[model samples]
Target: MRGWITFAVMSVVTLILLAPIFNIVILSFQGPQTLSGDPVWTVDNFVEIFTQTPVLTYLTNSLLVTLGTTVFGVVIGALAGYPLSRLRNRFARGYSLTLFVVQGLPVIVIVIPLFVVFAAIGLADTLSGVAIIFIAGSMAVTCWMMASYYDSIPYELEEAAWVDGASVFGAFVRIVLRNSYPGILSAAIFSFLVAWNDYLVAVVFLRSESNFTLPIGLQYFFQQNSTDWGPVMAMSVVMLLPPVIIFATLNRYFSIGGIGGAIK
Candidate 1:
């Protein structure tokens, strides 16, 4: 009875969470309103968005920025984290605390200053500029997450590799990183989401339509008097695909026991 009740509660919660997503997908397939103000079912929304808007260009820009952020975030996070996990010094602890504080800081706070700096440095209105901001915004949290994951890994494994004449960096590459896939993926996912879904930073920094990410490009479906919600939802569905695919493909790699038995 308890188990059945728990399942029922969970099902209700799942439906509540999925209701908005379900609505977006359904609305994306809706066609023009009939004389009676009813929406007819059609694929015209998808076609219109593809044919009329530069959604493909937006998608490409988003992909590039997200890919760059993910790769750099994982690499830099791992590098920074490895030291924080291994070191027991004052500087390392202070740095970790600083990261924690920085992670809590809102992105809206520094965006103006960053815009000024980027504008002066010739990075304004560029996709690369948006990518850099995404990386910077998420890097602190990524480092902390990577460091916490590294703590779970047995340091003795690296010690054994060092005993076999592997240099510190070599041991980290062959042993530590080899077992750190879950952490890497976690950081990559965070960075990808940041770059892919960011509207504020992209809107502030990206001036050219050519450099606009998907989140900013979605505004093209809007007009002065009326909003074309179908294409907007279609673009939203398009925006949803990458993250869904990434999570689905990488779900199997996220295992807590990935490092289990490495010591024994």
Candidate 2:
């Protein structure tokens, strides 16, 4: 009875969360002229988005930035986390606190300064520039996340590997990381979301139409076609797909491991 009650409550919460997403899917199918009318469904909005807009360019830019952010964020986060997890000293603690402080700082607070620096360095208006910005913005949180996950992992596994003549880095790569798929996936998704949905930094840094990521391009499309709810919502759906696909694909790899069992 208690389990059923818990399931019922969670089902209700799930529906509440999914309501807006379902609305977007519905809106994406409605014809522009009938958005507020009888809800006539058509593929016209999807057709127009492909035929009439540079959506492929926007998609490419978004993929580049998001992929770059996710890859770099995960690698750096995992590498940096090693020291924080294994080292039980003041320096490591101080660095971990620094990461926490950086993570707590709002993006808006640092974006302007970053813009000035990027402008001076001629990184403004480039996809690579936007990707670098995303990497920097997501790095602190990624570090903290990876560190916390590493903290949960017992160090005995690495010590066992060490006794087998494995170097610190090799033991980390082979033992610790093999057990950290869930944490890595979480950080990857977080970085992907940050780069995928970013608008403020993209708007400030990217001026060229060809360099615009999907979020910025979507905003422009909405501003120009404010009354056309169909295509607007279609673009919203497009923006939602990559993260969904990523989570679905990587979720299978998320599980606890028996790294410590290897020792005894």
TM-score attained by model 1: 0.94
- Candidate 2: worst 10 consecutive residues by lDDT? 255-264
TM-score of 2: 0.93
Q: Model 1, 1-264: lDDT tens per residue?
A: 999999999999999999999999999999888999998999998998899889999999999999999888888898999889999999999998898888887888989999999999999998888888888788887898888888988888999989999999999888888888888889989988888888999989988888888888877445511456887888889999999999999998798435776765
CA-RMSD of model 1 = 1.8
- Residues 81-167, model 2: lDDT tens digits: 888878899999999889878878888998889889988998988988889988888998888888888888788788888999999
Provide the TM-score for each candidate, comma-separated. Answer: 0.94, 0.93
Tell me the lDDT of candidate 1. Answer: 0.87
Model 2 global lDDT (CA atoms, 0 to 1): 0.88
Model 1 alpha-carbon drift over 4 Å, by segment: 33-38
